[model samples]
Target: MLFDCIPSHEIPELLHCDWLQSCDDEATVLGLLDIFTSLALESSAPDNSRPGVLAALIKHARVLAEYVQRCGPDAVTTRSFIQWILAKTVAELRMEPGFHNVGLDRWDRLVINQGESVHLPVFVPLKPSEKPSWRMFLTTSNTTQESAVKVAYRAALHTDDLSLQAMALKLLSLQLEDPREPLRTLSLLQMGMQGDIDGFLSTSLSRYLLVEHLSDARSLVQELSDLDNLSGGQSLLYSGVNPCLLWARDVILGHLLAVISGQKRAGNREWERNSSLHRFEFQT
Candidate 1:
């Protein structure tokens, strides 16, 4: 049904073609996603376009996202079959122009997880001097106090530069050192964060604490377990920039300290005063 809408030539190449099953390169995948998304939209037009391709591409995209994220690809060759399909989609299709590669952001993450930043080059045409990308290489794997502390300070201890990541990590480590309170660190970090949109804050923090870093991360549990006089807003605000906000060498020293020492939770939403730390409800 998807083929009926396209110019005669475009249909056979895409349909008769097992294009979706054949890609393994990053660029090819982006090219394919863009090409397929376009084809799907075109084919779905009221006049003659096949609506099926739109559904098909969305399906392909999910599969593509999985393949990129969890691929078992061998080194020195195709990383994913998705890459091959992409190459097929692009090489032969009559495609709409100007589709900038949005999928690159998705794939670049895959590259980062594998400790491989090289894949970034294929998606964006980078300058020759761009340093090989790196992320917070860490201390250990579990949530043992030591590991938790490591997770909090993961970025500052590792990478260079005052990237938002460093600001966050530095603040969190300060928390570790000052478990009695986080106000000073919060004050320091607040000054550094310019126009604090949620995306910018979340992304900066996330890039530093990636899923890989968290391991068995239940941050909400941690936060609920140990909040103090400063207000959850202050605690989370500080943590957003760095893990050291409660600088406990482990949960017991830092967290238990907070549990026993935490200021009384006010009758109402006092913590919600700061927009950043107060949004997620504390559903006790």
Candidate 2:
């Protein structure tokens, strides 16, 4: 029914092929998602032209979102897939000649909802340099707090640069639990510089403490989170610029002592907490 109004020449064979119907394995599902996302993003029409094409794009995005929601976190590839869908949607919305925004907001909601449904962190792209280091914080399996804390501390100390130190501190904060609230506060201040939106947003602070940061960053964070349109040249959040806003050289001693003390919360609103940190209202 989706293709009924669209011209046959503009449609990809994958849309009509039987291959998608038999999607049973994660690989197949990923392939289909890739195809759908590609079609939605790559094939474009002007705002007033080809209404059916835009409709089809929206439909593909919804289907992909629903399928990814059901995949759960155990599906490793789903993380990247969801991020791609989100990035693609955002890209389309940014284009001046692309389809209208009429139906695209739903796709944004769908991808964000899918991310929340499966406890996947909102997948903001990290810079090339930050990716390997960020991955270091992620364990193949859950590691103990003591170990995680130690790893985070080492990461913090690994670099002398303030931004890098701030990034390490952000990673370290995730490992710290309770009582270390003072350190967390200091770390927040360290990362508070106005220039580093992506680094700040990419951290757990934004995902884990969304409401607090929303209040802290004021409308800036909310606007960044909204992704309505790209008035700026390009988004730091998506364009891959990483700089830690919190963490400094002078406070290593204090951080070490405070770290010896102990660090964490879920927040309100769908956008505000990490889904894993708190059970979403829909889950319970």
| TM-score, one value per model | 0.21, 0.28
Worst ten in a row by lDDT for model 1 = 116-125
In angstroms, the error of model 2 at 75 is: 3.8
Candidate with the greatest TM-score versus the true structure: 2
Residues 1-284, model 2: lDDT tens digits: 88778675446444635566665566676676666655544343322244455456556556655666687854423433533433243233334332222433322221122111111123221111111122222212124433433443344344333433343343334333332353344335454543444434333333332222224334433433443232276643245433121111111112222223331111122223233333333210
Query: Which residue pairs of candidate 2 clash?
Result: 176-263, 177-263, 178-263, 190-245, 190-246, 190-247, 191-245, 191-246
State the displacement of the C-alpha of residue 115, model 2, in Å, after optimal TM-score superposition: 30
Q: Which residue ranges in model 1 land beyond 4 Å of their true spot?
A: 1-30, 33-58, 61-264, 267-269, 276-284
What's the distance in Å from true for residue 109, model 1?
30
Could you tell me which 10 consecutive residues in candidate 2 have the lowest summed lDDT?
125-134
